[model samples]
Target: MSEEYYAARIPADIDRPDAVVARLTFRQVAIIAGTGAACWLIFTAVHRAAPHLPLAILLAPLVLALTVAAGIALGSRDGISADRFLLAAARHARRPRLMVHAPEGIPPMPSILPKAWRRAAGPRPAPLVLPAAGVDGAGVLDVREHGYAQIAACSTVNFALRTSGEQNALVTGFGRFLNSLSGPTQILVRTRRMDLTGLVADLEEAAGALPHPRLEDACRDHAAFLAHLSAHQQLLGRQVLLVAREPQAAAATDAGLRLSRRHAESGAVLAGAEVSVVPFTPAGAYGLLADAIANENPGGFQ
Candidate 1:
């Protein structure tokens, strides 16, 4: 008998809205209905005011314009609806251009400063509200009312290169890990610019310690190649992070303990799939948070 393999296809847009009427989503239907209602109300009000007037001819242009506008708003470009794109554009225009780290809020200008000078200085910068309150010594994040969170760095697996049986085993083990989750868990994948300066320096330092001259030359040549690559080309490195969060409880200790246990269980389960998980230290966690925040806000925290 021959072995059989089956694959399931899942849509990328899992959260896409369901169609309610004529293949249109609820939001689209509401927009279209609301526009028609508004147009009808306008026509009725005008008709009541002037019973002898030619209502259809007078209101025809107004109604047509409104209908066209509604249709345009319903249309989507590049997978984004026109209405949503306009809303996002409006929000971007209204948001502050500059942001500063101020938990309490941006303070008012000192009374000592001249009114004209203060006016010329422009509006106060917006505050950068981060989710994390602080990181403790144990690498646990205090998220205020939200609760505590712990992060672990995870290594990737090359499933495409593995044999069919190995791939099935990996998938089964990963499924088991997902089934074991008891609380909120998040997997974040990001790419950052790669730096090879440290690697090049290490290679050069070890080259002199080689037993043979030929070996030393080869090491030096490899180090030079790495240095040239780093200097000439743009390189990026991928990072996979697992985040486990526990909601706030009466006892803070209990929340931390729960988060830690979840992290350990995740590591143990992922190990079956040949994924190594390493929990970040306090300093490492703080650094990661800072880098993430800096990326989001170009101005960075003050």
Candidate 2:
């Protein structure tokens, strides 16, 4: 092969320019010309009206020049005009439009067409996709979308209550567990406001079932105290999740085997760390996601 043949076929400057010229779009040029013309006309009229005020006339052009410079600097839209930006913003604001439905008995409001209102169709709600399809009897969650099949759940411990030595041991054990991981895994911590509704309901039921008046009264008082505390205190619930995902390429029959192996390994690791771990079922996973979403956006599911 010739040495010259190995060189680039084209000059670099031909494909990529060494120096690019800065230019303005039609709208920007029009705006600048119009503003300059209007300012010139105003300045001329003011000078003619007050011929003696020479200082005012001199200051007018200086102020106009400064105003024009500021507008050009601040009104920038990546070298595009403000009109295009406004149009794009208006279009984006129209997404996820809402629809209203009237009751069967009540008559619908008379449709009043306004000149500015464009009758575009309202956007539909997006479909919900759960992380896991279902859990097998062997306790493996089938996350079909991500191409992973595994069992996972959260483990919690009161770190503040542990001694320095205990905390050190716990950290060392967890470090070793992470080093031993041979597949994909995720550790997450989610915090949410504690929901005491169920506890309140249970207390109410217990109070109602109590035969003795004194015991029933005490139960009611305790329930009220708990409700008050929950209302006044900002109680937060923190859940630590450990998710292990095995490769989906494993055979269908082998899914259960892989799940069991991963589950046992993770549990043993947690046990060694002196932390209790709970494996989440498919339903549990779904509920967890729903709760998380709800906490992030109130009434989001509804």
Candidate 3:
């Protein structure tokens, strides 16, 4: 008897809008219809005003321009429709240029500054609303009204190097973990620039204390190689994090307890798949959150 493997083909465009008419999406159809209606209204108004004007002279250019505009709106660039891209661009243009990390709200400009100078200073800074309210000593994040979430750092599995049977086992274990999830869970994978300067420093410091001269020399050479590598090449480090969130309860302590239990359950399940999960400490979790915010907003926050 042979093992059986079943596979199904899934569309890459699962989020794509469905075509409603003539292979055109509802949005595209609406754009075309709106353009046509506007053209008709213009044509009617112009003809009523000047009955002597030729229809071709009035219709040709107007229809051509509107049709092109509608076509552009229907078209897509970089996987996003032109209409959506334009809307996003307009929104970005209207948004405040400066943002400050004030959870309460942005205060009014000082009364001391002259009114004329204040007017010339452009728009006032907008408040930055972050998702996580705070983190506890146990690394559980307080998401305010949403709930508490605990993040566990997970070790990766080398699926590509595994045998067919091993791969099947791993998949089965992962599927089990997914099936066991009761609340909102998120798996995050991110890459950050790797800094080897500290590692090189540690190696250099330890090299002098080696028992043998040859061992000391080897350690020194390795440290030099790492320093050279860090200076010449860009290195990236990948992190896999599992976040388990439990909805807020009447008592905050109950919510935190539920989140911790969920985190432990997830770790136990993942262990079957040869993956180790370690929850981040308070300081580590806060540091990760800060770094993530800085990366996302860049110069927007002071």
Candidate 4:
């Protein structure tokens, strides 16, 4: 990546700062600007028409001030500049979850205008644009769940190369596994990217500290191998596959939670944790897969 692109990414050392943009909504800016313009125009006209009238001149400042104040007060719901930003805080907050690492000392985020909102009815919380809450681990909410299930995945296999006996065993085992399920299930896939800088970094030590010349070549190869892997990975997106079924549909039917089709034909609920069904990755689906390798001899390790 170019230096500019790297610089664009969030830096590792600095915590994301709170927003500083005090963007007045279109309505607020219009109201204030319009009122200020009108008041100033009127003040100018009055001064021109009544140049001898000291009293009218004396009231010009008050008129301009009142117009500006009214615009600010009415447009902003009475809060000063600070409260306007505070009202936007929720948008930056993420959804609440169970597994997120709640920092030990949840220091309140600082604000420049702590008391600004006392002046008006700032923007409603729902209207702000907010970043997503970035927590994904089993949230505190999930850990507290009354019941949950974990599943494993099965590896992809070249079944066509297997003997008839092996194929039959595999087919039979899969059929039996499918029959074992009962519950509501939802399949979820999580994907992410990783920085491979650490892997590439070991090259320096390999080059500098290794005593054996051959080992240095090996280290160079390792670094090149890692570089190739990183290049491929950069082009390849992460994929996590899950196959889930919800027995919860049946439970919901019996337990009487509102149900929707999991699919048009398959009978799944739109939601409700009770929607329980067994789920597994491809790797999770097949048992004895590792043991069933073609070359496994008596007492030989896989």
Candidate 5:
């Protein structure tokens, strides 16, 4: 490649990738961990009488190897990329683009750099690809997207009602919708445990104002309610699933609310592309979010 081409690419890490240098497979990691543990026990038990060898030398590699193995095993397979964030910054120029903070920060790009690459390097190098921008390891997806698609998280409806027919009808409608899709479609589901720290604080504050005897009763009731809620929540943490058709195959419709002509000046959906994330809930709520995405990005509706 020409020097100009090389200048455009992000510099590879000076250190070798853990996978390449350590020969540290997941199995090796497990072995290293176990070996270190065993070595520790052996050295501590025998080192007093057998002080001929420096035990640290034998164990140092084990510790170092174990740390690398742990990091490799835990790190995302795909590192952060810098395409979509750049595009959004160029296209709309008005929205808050989700981005992973670059290690060295976005740097300057040479004159030969592509517009996309230049955007990723605001002042330094932040690797971001548009397609992967909202992916798990890429930039966090902004809550909104322009032409690509639209999504909203709806609260889940509790299904513990006594009315069987109502539940059956709802499920039947959902099943029919799933069966109706033609071409490329995708569904995403998300769920999360609800946080009630503020609620807990409020309850504590209320209890503090009560008389001593009544406060005990309040505490007991609060504890019981909390336990009950926790048990129920543990069984039913939030989850959301996405169902979508490919942008090109989606039916025609108006786009979601773009931030603003002025605000959107900094961010734009280059194509019918978008990603939104919300805490997961039950299937019905997830289905509603799918509908919302389709509604917001009409052209992509299928």
Candidate 6:
């Protein structure tokens, strides 16, 4: 494969600090220019009509401020200017080029705004599907609305600590495992900040339970040392996941049979690679999803 083919492709609309200046579209520029011209015309007409009036003099600064505000409002749509609001309004209009009406017979969606504002607001896009629902007995995950069932949770080997010969063997084994794969799979490696709350609590408990003063002092010192290390170090833990996906309707088949086959195949491949692997149980998979939703890291072996 070509290097360019494998290269990461960032979207054109991806936000960056310099994008505000660099990514000005034609619509954004038009909105800003139009607002400025309208404001200028209105200000000039008022000034010309009542040049000697005291009120006109006071209104000059106010008119200038209003012009600036209007320009800002019109230009600030979707990072560029207020053209986004105009586009949304245009799209939501009855005779829009493309109109997507709400489904019939269902209650209108709730909005945070008051009723009048809600009515004035443009139509919004439908909500996206949740990333995951829960896992099944076959260690497969029910990815709700995504039309896929997945099984995940795999372990890794410590490659850096291994000798040259061991590393070569590991590389060969991994290559073989990859070559043996017939279907699609996703391999994920995630690194998360380690939480030491439980360890600190355990250490405190152990320290309190010690009978001898010297031992208790020693335990306290050890706990304090651990606490210090936790505070100072950016301790990170890494998890490996191997996800096998099938159709959501595959649930109709025997779950045990499916899980056993997947487990046996993966186990044999990983065993040859000299890597420790464990499959998450249904409850474990659910817990993993829940933890991910809550943004909690619940593991060790850092």
What's the best-to-worst order under lDDT?
Answer: 3, 1, 2, 6, 5, 4
On a 0 to 100 scale, what is the lDDT of residue 50 in model 2? 85
Instruction: Estimate the lDDT of model 3.
Output: 0.85
Error of 6 at 3 (Å): 32
**TM-score of candidate 3 against the unseen true structure:** 0.83
Instruction: List model 6 lDDT by residue over 30-60, tens digit each.
Output: 5556666776787778778878768666567
- Please give the ranking of all candidate structures by TM-score, highest first, separated by commas: 3, 1, 6, 2, 5, 4
Q: Is candidate 3 or candidate 4 better by TM-score?
A: 3
List the candidates' TM-scores in order.
Answer: 0.82, 0.53, 0.83, 0.30, 0.31, 0.54
List ranges where model 4 is wrong by over 4 Å.
Answer: 1-165, 185-195, 202-211, 228-302
Candidate 2 contains a number of clashing pairs equal to 0
lDDT of 4: 0.43
lDDT of 2 by residue, 1-302 (tens): 32221222666545322332245545555666667777777777877888788867567675778576447633747655455666788897875444222222333333685534423522333334445555555556666766555546656667678766677667777777887777787887878889787898899999988989999999999999889989999989887877777766465458666655766787788776886667776556556655765545322221
Report the number of backbone clashes for model 1: 0
Per-residue lDDT, model 6, residue 32, is: 58
Give residue 232's lDDT in candidate 1 (0 to 100): 97
TM-score for candidate 4, residues paired by index? 0.30
Better of 1 and 4 by TM-score: 1
- The predictions' CA RMSDs to the true structure, in order, are 3.7, 15.4, 3.6, 19.7, 20.8, 11.9
Per-model C-alpha lDDT, please? Answer: 0.84, 0.64, 0.85, 0.43, 0.44, 0.64
Identify the leading candidate in terms of TM-score: 3
Better of 3 and 6 by lDDT: 3
Candidate 2 residues lying further than 4 Å off, grouped into runs, are 1-120, 123-142, 149-151, 208-214, 232-234, 251-253, 295-302
List candidate 3 stretches off by more than 4 Å: 1-4, 52-74, 103-106, 120-122, 295-302
